[model samples]
Target: MPQHHDPGTADAPEGQASKSGFRPTAVAAVELGVVGQSVGVTVPGASESVQVTGISLDSRTVERGDLYVALPGAARHGADFARTALEAGAVAVLTDDAGARLLALGSDIAVPVLVVAEPRSVVGRLSRLIYRSQDADLPGPSMFGVTGTNGKTTTTYFINALLQAMGKKTGLIGTIEILAGGDPIPSLLTTPESTDVHALLALMRERGLDAASMEVSSHAVSFRRVDGVVFDVVGFTNLTQDHLDLHGTMEEYYRTKAELFTAERARAAVVTVDDEWGRRLAAQTELPVTTLATIQPGSGPEADPAGPAGADWTVTDSKPRGLGTEFTLRGRNGTELRVHTGLPGAFNVSNAALALAMVLAGGADPAEVQAALDSKDPFTVAVPGRMQLVSTRPAAVVDFAHNTDALARALAAVRSPEPASKVIVVFGATGQRDQGKRPSMGATAARLADVVIVSDDDPHDEDAAAIRAEVLVGATDAKEAEQLDCKIMEVYPRDAAIREAVNLAAPEDTILIAGRGHEVWQEVKGVNLALDDRVELRNALTARGFTVLQDDGIES
Candidate 1:
């Protein structure tokens, strides 16, 4: 049977607390009436003394003294779960009229019911009011938010690394993990829900972390996940085709990302003017904007000089440094800072450049930024799945390049310059996403890679075979139309595809496992299958006598 999961909501962990078990413990309970009135919603039958110390959107994550917000979901109303929220110690419920009626039908739900005209719209304001997330009196961490189709995760990781290099304690929120000066908490979405986001920010402040960096995805912006949080600096990586399933068009997607740069959300901006979208966003944003340009091999030709030519900061004198690259950040004001990243791929150079530029935008002294770069080499830090290296022999690597442009760039970045060395790429498009990109991804692999292997990537209730066939169509068409010399094959159950790539590879060849990086699970027909690409690549490489790198205490 096909398991139907809610597309609108993330598959959040089912518990009262996240893995970190960190929530605002010192919160002063706010009255239910006061909370409702703060968001312009009315609490009719609720007592004025009914107090809530926390806010939660998912019933399963409800804690004691929580205002469980029952927003309307696509497949089912959250009101349907109000009884469970009550059972999980939710003291009150905030929902729309439909939810109020549903609660009325469920007589056992006797808690306060605060009705709102639009429950989702008011959730952020209500959460802020209850949590004091952005109260001017409290000292909060300086927040940085990054958005785009491809580089959001890597850029945010770079931002956190640079901040740490500058001697500031840091927290990170992104697709891979969440950090709050403690152990890493695995993340489900690029950004968490507004309620959890506020709680995490408060937790960072309580822990005395000086700064935090977050990946602001298009879905996060569209779904109100980042509602109450404002950033000290916001960055725009180049926007490309993605999330069309949600935004319906490239224009809408660009608009959704641009929303994060408003004065309300961020104080300053760092725009990477490598593409027209970044140029448009830099011009259109009301916040004070700082433009950056990186002319890198992975980014292809410069965008006609309309974007990067007249930028505030430009990456100049870039040269290859082993597997990585070394570049100079030349400011228009004659300030030059040397930058180097051990991470491979020209795109990583761009990501590194953006990170350095953003730290300066966030009020870090330029000399301090330079000192950090010189001392720590922060941009060279290993970002878990963004171009993570697994083996020296065969040069096995994994990355999160699901979109066409990203795939093209990743393939270009990993292709060896050695004339005899081949690029074997194992990749597949995600199911239930923007289906239009699958063929483009296929053609991209066929063009750049010596061997194109189409495999499964999170089929998620969609037919895996059908998804593979779509990708195969593009690869096959490209091979024939362009008479490309790439060998194309279809493989199933991703692990086998990975093993096949290893079996086909030579010691000098490069194996790129794209589309799933750092992600440990593959969802198929609604069940999460434990599948880590790095682990698989490592095990396969070691079995074939390839020397693998040590990771997470696992000796090579």
Candidate 2:
């Protein structure tokens, strides 16, 4: 959904089903008669009949006894793959009139065809029908969803960790990976396609999980990947400039995000009022809404004492603890809890707070969520790449900050330790995505960090140097306009960029390598090479005379 990266980058292959073989129970065409009636499609050839065991959007993954969905796509028609799906033993084909017209032109398509009006919109419901029957039917876990420009992954991870702390088997879906009450599985998309989402839910049900948390991206919302999901409690962590390429405008982006707060999408919602977008969303949502704010004097100068936000839950106290921070959340009903997070910075505090509220809203035990938030316990929720420290002497950290807002926040969080600690940041924009953010990121980095290293992020096909030049324009503007003392340097390969940052920093300074979080592969011209930032940072630090340890709990 986030414009697929390569085929096998981080996600499992399409045909590589779960060990349990993700196919749900078989359903007859008569069973899905309701789906057809809703869309005015009739299944021909009365096999009454054929039972479909699986539903696949990708023709490549369709197995015998499976029904393949054929729909129009952005680049090409899914009907083009109908022959492949038929060859893969698919029982029948489901498509709209457009795809049916394409099938009519082909002479070899002899399988049953069921037409639908909008395949994308009904596919989620169809997936649920193929997998789950009802919310109360199986041992399925209650779901929680989080959406925003940033913090979706961290917040979902936080919710998953808390659910586990409460002694519930948890399933997690995020940008980095997916955990279906089993081991961590590489995530193909931030929010997977609807068919995968329903399949994963069924898989979690089979594994005896009690709860699951999913990160819902705006793209997933606009593209109907999450059309039929019913989240127990959805969360909104501040939205900023992002994904304008997909939504076309900021208003459209906000509307797409707002779609999740409706009763159809979620049972209830928790919103952070740290930004105007969050405030507007909270005010507009019709479902049961709970507001969480880790900061006072919210995004605007206004605060409503009797409204859903600022009136429901507010942070009344805060203090920086050793290696972490502590804060207090108060409910409008006079409920209060003292919380501590092993993570640093106020943004993480907001994340933890929002996570706590959403889980609580989803019927988790309050005592357990609060206990999990206690700083004295073993740290259970650590995001893989957000402000992760690789070297202590120079305080070199790696973050997934590709946008202006995220980059500025990462620099601010790193600099929060001490005023005397200077900052050196290394990052570059991805090729052909939100090109407008490039110069904005440059200006933000120059304004916040003492040194900016402009380098490659993932130059898909565009000339890498040309993209760098556009970013340099903003860096030059920031340097000249503010008369800042920051020095700008251009570097090739991101690995060399890390080395440059290490070379520029001293024992007292901070070095931040931004963009590309837990991603292990780097996209260049269609090829995804191994280029993890953590590995590169540790290698650069070790090469620059710093101790580096292997991931296996041992020093290399």
Candidate 3:
């Protein structure tokens, strides 16, 4: 059994100064059971009790009275930094059994030590307990979570815009920004840490917000970043090959995502059964799952119509108009409504249907959902960098499509309008992750694009050139003896590569910039430099003096 500490029992001395801006409140302590006797400790000071003000894994961010969590890494153990954490004001340490043994040799630092079976697994729970004990006290807002391999950001934007149209105050959290009451803050991760997440929720409560939409990534679920938070409704767009480096296999990745659908978290689920995995997920969960289909060919015979059956949703007769998309969303009840969205690609219709289903399942009136859809044109809340068309003459599209599945879909969507148009692609694989997908990504681009430009995308600590080489292997494998016309270029710098692709593009051609969509920074080695692909494309187009009409159809 687990025990929690009471903040009231471990009050600081009357004269002791506080370091953190947030007060050391008994409220926080009561929330996270920080008090207790030593349980299986090896260090001399293991028996001692200490009040942990906060929890942090990074030594640099540790404050006085904080408990530093030392996790083992491939290159170095967190125990290596125990001394540094102590010097930086960590009063106690939480680590594994082996780490406790190593700390016993140290005689100078006599801090309380807690030995746990697995610190990584418990870190999220501890963080949640510490920060989100009274999460219900936070204002209740209609919360929506968008999860899928692609279009999460865009779908999140659509939901936010629709909610705002209904005159509800809304906030957004995704790969682009952490928005609260319409204030935009730069984001560090797709899903923030559990502590930050609860803190944000508390802030939203303070702001009197009506609704909030978030993009939940696979990493967030796997790491339990959303452990204690409640979602009114969870929306699934689709899933594809991605993050193989973190999750060793596709099944593991799917399982990690499925964790969000458990009885404890989401009240209801809206899943897009566009892929086989989604259908399987719908079958496994007992939650009132609403199935949505956007594929033009109509629900496949293998698709479980009974799942999304009566009163469910599907997109029909989707047509891409100038800078926008027009489609008809027909519900199971036979209610047909027209929706014109600024989002590009045929995939967006599916995304819109998912958002609509989630809103309806969350108790929003179906008629209100329709009114929201009709009150405004869809392009108003376009997600930046997702299927964003920058030029008309050469028809350039900047998307976050990184995997083979997403890339293939993007290419197919762009090629649908102009079958004979020459397609040029600019893309690169991230270093230190999913190395196996490198060849697949390359092959997908080479198969679709007349010319493929391989460049660097967040090559952290790995050689950029080597990363590009792996991508080239896929391109070479894809190039058959009969089709030697497909050209491949290796450019180290991403900006240079984008410029090359733009220069190579001619009128009636399409340049597809894949990966790193809406990301404002480029991660190189260990540093994050300011870089936006959309801005770069605009600059390149301007320099080349290309006079192309901006397609406002795809939301930015």
Candidate 4:
């Protein structure tokens, strides 16, 4: 129900704009009776002339001529706020029998109440109908969705950049921000609710955008946030242990991610065969899948030139190009592409390759894609907070590496080859998340970094000291058990930890600030504190006489 409004961008209908900046300029209105019949529901005593122009789940954000969906929540039923929704100009209400009964207990509301068996299940389908996003007569943008435990945000940004490189107007939805070819809107989730998703798609069509890239998280697939939306092409970056707190296990997490590659959700898919999960997904999905094998630095013997047999495309011939890497993408029939990414790490090479392959799999002309690669260098476009280089003297970098695998990759990517150079890391596990990953993250830091400073991340409704202690447990255990030669320390007040890292660094050392990238807020006890790692790191480095680069700009 929190809206980030940017006026003068589009001519929206009166009261059509809502939270998450989804404002369609027009709505092809549908009658309430037709909507009920479409979703196999009947509205008792509903007027045939009543029309629905929009849909909303939150009562506070219901627009004029909108259908308010009152789904039951864990704490309170949405029907309890029916009066608030009706007063906000909702034309009709859609709820289940329990919601209807809850409505009956209150003062009689005159709006139409359409009763359904499961209101949440039909919210997506109904939103699509009302928004007219996928109509045969009027098509929406070419949708591209990327899903994985890692690299989703960067891959989506890469996809958008590639589309723009090919002279296409692009929109993006991800953990960073929502861009509808205009000013960027702050995002609250990886994927917004079904209503906002459909509405934003319609807005993209209205603005004449050609393509849109989205980051589809496992939570979005499980929560029905992307139910009605189907992608022209879907992409899979390698999966690892993540979001186990939500899915309960690694198998369940994989199962939730597999939902995005279904025949109903996506037309085609490009799977990265860097791990067993990606290979299994490529083999199991019914969608036409193109498998890719990107050989990074530490992939061991399995990352050969003839990467996984039957791989439709393979990335090989990688060489260092300044701070980035130049790699060749070899495909079937002796076809190849010369790719370059002006970003650090071999993982970025994988991200760039996946972006290019996904664009090609979506039916872009190969010659045009190559031309874009030559002219635009789309893969080098800066993605906020993904290996963002803040300063050069100590080589301070900020990355969104929250999990154990990501932490190891980030630490490895920033290590200096000089024997005297040390790696200083400042990180901590997020509270109210998978607590099981705390020790592993600490262990990874201890094994990879020369100095590990465990600090507080978002400690939402949890003790910050307790969270830090758990991480220190892993760091201390790894240091003692493996006899690792790393200095481990516990620090508090995250900005102080950043300053500490900069204070302990020589010009030859590299400072890696892991976790909480691009996020400007830290939640503790349900209150958001202003905290941007890039900003803090820049200020700290500047205070220490180190040169800082502009936002996400890399000079190598």
Q: Name the best candidate (by TM-score).
A: 1
lDDT preference between candidates 1 and 3, better one: 1
Model 1 clashes, total count: 0
Alpha-carbon shift of residue 519 in model 3 (angstroms): 2.8
- RMSD to the native, candidate 3? 7.3
RMSD of each: 2.7, 3.9, 7.3, 4.4
| lDDT on C-alpha atoms for all candidate structures | 0.85, 0.77, 0.73, 0.87
Off by over 4 Å in 4: 1-20, 44-46, 296-298, 301-307, 551-556
Question: Rank order by TM-score, top first?
Answer: 1, 4, 2, 3
lDDT of each residue in 1-556, candidate 1, tens digit only = 2322322457743331333254766788998889877877667764777988998887767888999888877778888887777887889888889888878887767787888888888787777888887789998899988888878888888888888888899999988888998898778878888888888888888888999999999888888989978899999888888889999999999999999999888899999988889888989999999999887324465354443667899998889998999999989998899999988877888888888889888888889888998999888778888888888778888999999988988988888887799999999989999999899899989999999999999899899999999999999999999999999999878999999999999989999999988888788887877788988989899898888887632222
lDDT per residue as tens, model 3, 277-340: 8877888976778888776444443335444433278787777676567888888888777787
Model 1 residue 327 lDDT score: 92
- Lowest lDDT 10-mer window, candidate 3? 4-13
Q: Once model 2 is optimally superposed onto the true structure by TM-score, how far is the C-alpha of residue 218 displaced, in angstroms? A: 0.3
Off by over 4 Å in 2: 1-35, 133-135, 298-309, 375-380, 416-420, 549-556
User: Which candidate would rank higher by TM-score, 1 or 4?
Assistant: 1
**In terms of TM-score, how similar is model 2 to the real structure?**
0.91
RMSD versus native structure for model 1 = 2.7
Model 2, 1-556: lDDT tens per residue?
Answer: 1222212113343444433234334433324454455556765556435676667788766777767898777666888788877888887888888989989998768777887777777888887777662357565788899998988888888888777777788988888878887777777678777777887887887777899899999988887778778998999987778888788788989999999999988899999877768888988999999887766763322333433344477776878786567778788778787877776556777787888888778876666666765633423356788766676677777789888888887887788366577899999989978888889999988998888999999888888998898888899898999998888999988888888888877778888889987767787887777788888888788877875534412112
Off by over 4 Å in 3: 1-54, 62-68, 75-93, 99-114, 298-311, 378-380, 416-420, 481-485, 524-530, 547-556
